[model samples]
Target: MSEPHVHASHPDIARRPRRAEGQLRKVIEMTEAGRNCLDIAQQLQAVESAVAGAKRTPVQDHLDHCLEHAVGAMSRDQRQSIDAFKAITKYL
Candidate 1:
């Protein structure tokens, strides 16, 4: 198999999900310990926000670098696919 492609923002973006994972573990622990609902909800929200930030980092990097820097060399079909990807990532 070919090597996997890594984005330029990989290192920075990777930290986010790890933070979210840690937040998630805390949330799970809080739940098991019968912590206040609101506190657990708050930690869950933190996890969600961390995950969203992680997701946005790479999408923003793609727009800033991949599409912006490589657009001129891409064929029309390739451009269309990139457009489609941009449309899809907006929901991230």
Candidate 2:
């Protein structure tokens, strides 16, 4: 079996989602308490933005580290696959 590859630790990456989770919990509580519509909407937007940032960070890190490091060495098939993945992540 192949060994697993280890990436560098990114504390900031973990922080984004943890903060978003707290924001989400607060939004839930606000909803339960019948908070103002505008306030709830604003908080919900912030949560969504935080979640998106959390996702984007790791993907960007992977591209910056894993894929970039391998660019000159990868086979044509591997390059194509990575390019396809990069294109698809645009929707994220």
Candidate 3:
């Protein structure tokens, strides 16, 4: 496969960041309002988690679509990218 096939995950993955964006904005507002520390921390954590989840979807989609293409074409660079991507997920 020369080009990646569009996997079914794209639409949902696209939406995930939008939700996180709103949540992140709320975090800023909450900070400005001098919200309780615990509440702020909780919301910040939620935002971080949401953002992480949103990122995971696209990375996973890339792995599903692009990696398959790369493997089929025997591209070492893409394989190396897959390895690098997987290594970073330990932090995620």
Best by the TM-score measure: 1
2 or 3, greater by TM-score: 2
Ranking by TM-score: 1, 2, 3
What does candidate 2 score on TM?
Answer: 0.69
Q: Estimate each model's TM-score.
A: 0.71, 0.69, 0.64
Residue 10 in model 2: lDDT = 71
Clash count per candidate: 0, 0, 0
Residue pairs that clash (backbone atoms under 3 angstroms), model 1: none
Q: Each candidate: what lDDT?
A: 0.87, 0.83, 0.77
lDDT tens digits, residues 1-92, model 2? Answer: 99975556477778888989999999999999999999999999989988888788788778868877877678788788778888788678
Colliding residue pairs in candidate 2:
none
The residue-level lDDT of candidate 1 at 37 comes to: 100
Show model 3 residue runs off by greater than 4 Å: 1-5, 73-91
Best candidate per lDDT, number? 1
Mind sharing the TM-score for model 1? 0.71
Q: For every candidate structure, what is the RMSD over all alpha carbons to the true structure, in angstroms? A: 4.3, 4.3, 5.3
* C-alpha root-mean-square deviation, candidate 2: 4.3
As for model 1, its CA RMSD to the true structure in angstroms is 4.3
